[model samples]
Target: MNRYYWILGAFAALVVLLAVGLNLNPREVPSPLVGKPAPAFRLAVLGQADKTIGPEDMKGKVWLLNVWASWCVSCRQEHPVLVDFSRRGNGTPIVGLNYKELRGDGAIDMRRVPAEQEVPMALERAAGWLKEHGDPYLLTAMDIDGRVGIDYGVYGVPETYVIDKAGIIRMKHTGPVSPQVLNEKILPLVAELNK
Candidate 1:
């Protein structure tokens, strides 16, 4: 009887824990990297192979680092919001990290297929996509090998990080940035951090 009671108590505790976790927003999943210094990387510029950019270049400025890929459907959903934000000219630079993508069709996800011959093509495709869709980035960097993505702890494309002027990562949103999230969470935080 004592053993049975212990098992039941353990089961109830697991149920409570699961319930709490389920109630939390998936996008708001706490990252250990938050409040830490932003990961550093210097990658080739998307359009210009000779140029490179990274967090080091953006020091002393409050900025946004948006991780996106041409293959990510969610990135397309969030693009208009970012475009609008850029057009507003709020003085907050939006740096783009063009994550893993494949060649031939932009629909081919890099994670699903091994990318080797496709990288150069992917960069060309990305450049064309931005040209057609209207680029919102102050400068877009290419993470063709995805080492930079790993450094940033990117679980998926379309993640965004808001870095303060001091270069500390203040907020990380993992998913499409809808208008509601931009207005309710990101904008206010940026305003406060800038001050």
Candidate 2:
């Protein structure tokens, strides 16, 4: 019947659409927040809870807001690049948003690793990791509950945002910052925004 044929056609179309979506890279996913004002949040600094930081504090400066987690493997991959970039002191400041650091059962990864060896997911743990791995952030804010991350449309860890001096989000890079991404996308944008 024609009705049966129509149902088959619709099913085939859905299958094709799903296949295309699966092939798409998540990193290339366009952000709705691009060209919009960065989300605002004031949170306690990782190591210093008494001191808070937010978008308002960096209103007049071009900055990189790097959302990282101590547990994210991709963050480790990008750590050296961020560290080197921070040391270069290219005029753009780097701030860190430490998101979802605490876990009720203390499980940090999907591997289901034992809790005894699992890294503690707390602000102190993040501060320690930064100290041992080399702290690159001019200021680091703690988002233990990940509410701020939701506001910024974060899909996962290791997302980086380039905010212009006026506090507008110019670009967002999802995933580890490879040298090529830093050189080709971030650095050039930083130079342009600074000017």
Top candidate, metric TM-score: 1
RMSD of 2: 6.3
Which candidate comes out best when scored by lDDT? 2
Per-residue C-alpha lDDT of model 1 across residues 44-145, encoded as one tens digit per residue:
888777899979898899999999887788899999999999999998899999886653235566567555556678788789888877899999998876
Quality of model 1 by C-alpha lDDT: 0.86
Q: Every model's Cα RMSD, please?
A: 4.7, 6.3
Per residue, candidate 2 scores C-alpha lDDT tens digits across 148-173 of 99999987789999999899999999
Which residues of candidate 1, in runs, are more than 4 Å off?
Answer: 1-22, 26-28, 103-117
Q: Which whole-number lDDT from 0 to 100 does residue 21 have in model 2? A: 93
lDDT of 1 at 16: 100
TM-score of 1: 0.81
Q: Which lDDT values do the candidates have, in the order given?
A: 0.86, 0.86
